[model samples]
Target: MKVIKNIIFVAIVFLISIGLLVVGNGYDMYKDAISKIPLTEKVETIKEKENYTKIEEVPEIYIKAVISVEDHRFYKHNGIDIIAIGRATINDIKAMSFVEGGSTITQQLSKNIYFTQEKKITRKIAEVFMSLEIEKNYNKDEILELYLNTSYFGEGCYTVKEASRKYFGKEPKKMTDYEAIMLAGIPNAPSVYSLTKNPELAKQRQKQVINKMIEYKYLTQSEADKILEQ
Candidate 1:
């Protein structure tokens, strides 16, 4: 029993040490990135893009769909979703790899503007720090708009407006329910879900988005069916 207690204590301390080291590294990376380009200036630059789409300019359904699939608890969380992080942690532990990232829209926005797409613990931590900064400086709707404007939608489309025009030859606000839902899912894995490249996979991903919407009560089963039928 004494030996077992000692082992557990050591393990706990080791884990705490590793956690501190990771967070320290991430803070350094965050400072470096922010020094190069301040958050406010970076966000203003994105919002100034000719193709930047406002939250009101986008379809309500599309916004709901994105919230449902990307981060259902987006409105509830400040900058990070503890529930999502806990679930992702469990999954990653089981898989023994960083397979699932429970990134909130704010965190994704932080990465989009400040950090690389690299999947390192330090980068992830930096994203968390940046996410908090974003939440502090902007409203949730503003953060969502920034995320949409910066997300890559594949086929060289980097903004929601560009993706809408490229995919359906329409503006985001003019998108139909079906088109809106389809567009909402593409950014998850844009390369795989790009309609021009893999129509089947795009449809499959669209179904996933629809399912999430229904699950989140953004749409009923009938509504989802109608969208799919269209």
Candidate 2:
């Protein structure tokens, strides 16, 4: 609960602060997400052509944990989840700030691969369209694979394979459920919840992910508790 409150506060402050720092042309940025996203931008991006990890190569627990927390309705929805957006709207009104992002996994993948992370409604709208386009072109597993292969985990690791090795010195298939949950939660806000920079925050987010897993029926209460115990 405190973690959520803190996130809301931070998001409010960050959004207000970025109002002035909203750099780059919105038009160009919109074009970016709609078109091709560069592979290595000194930051990170999902490559379209090379070294993609197959869905079978990643652990099943990782996929379930990510979908459970990030977007339970990912397989059900076309791309955007209106229910999530409505829930976020309610929370935004109650908080009097736009802290909650009701974006689905595909929408996030859209943002990561297509557009810049500018906090603007217009960019979000563009992301929605691009997300739908991606859904139309790719299957659920394909989208998940692209998302997993492309996401940026903090500590300078852009790809999940790199993140698993760099953070735990293990391959993706070798990661435990707890490790998978922790990694699953990182892409939500990489810098703030980075395990190296803020282990507590990262752990708290992991707990949230576990809670979501339970809520979504991906794991039972005992299973979740056991994972947390580890």
Candidate 3:
């Protein structure tokens, strides 16, 4: 019994040590990234793009679709969503891999602007830190706008305006309900859902987006049906 207790204690300590090391490295990476390019400067560069579209320029349906599909609790959470993290953690454990990420919109924006796409614990932590910083400095609308502008929508479209013109040849504000929802779903897996590359897959993802919108109460079933009819 004594030996078993000792082994358990050692294991707990070892795990705690590893956790600390990971957190420390992540914090360092966050600091280094900010040092190279201040967050404000990075944001300015993006906003200064001639094609940048403000939140007001986007359709309400598109906004709702994105919030429903990407982060339903976007308006309620701070920079992080604890419930989402817990759910993702369980899913990741079950899969025995980093298969599910619970990144909030703010966190995704942070990663889009500052970090690489590679999935690593340290980078994930750094992204969290950056998210907190962004939340401190920007309002919800600003963050959402920035996220839309930075997100890739396949076909080499880097901003929402670019994607809108590339896919539909119309401004975002003029997008039909169906078009808005379809565009909202593209960012989830742009490479696979790019309308030109995979029209069928894009339609499937649009259905997923509409389902999420209904689940989140952003759209009624009838409204979704109407959108589909279009």
Predicted structure with the largest TM-score when compared to the true one: 3
Q: What is the lDDT of every predicted structure here?
A: 0.92, 0.81, 0.95
lDDT: which is higher, 2 or 3? Answer: 3
C-alpha-based local distance difference test score of model 2: 0.81
Residue ranges of candidate 3 with Cα displaced over 4 Å: none
TM-score of each: 0.96, 0.79, 0.99
Residues 104-127, candidate 2: write the lDDT tens digits. Answer: 998888787766777677687777
Superior candidate under TM-score, 2 versus 3: 3
Model 1 misplacement above 4 A? none
Clashes of 3: 0
TM-score of 2: 0.79
Query: How far off is residue 210 in model 3, in Å?
Result: 0.3
Candidate 2 clash pair list: 33-114
A best-first ranking of the candidates according to their TM-score comes to: 3, 1, 2
lDDT for position 181 in model 3 = 98
lDDT of 1 by residue, 1-230 (tens): 99999999999999999999999999999988988999888988998898989889999999999999999999899999999999999999999999999999999988888888988999999999989988999998988989999999998888999999999998889999999999989988999898998999999999999999989899999988888999
Pairs that clash in candidate 1: none
Residue 36, candidate 2: Cα error in Å is: 6.8
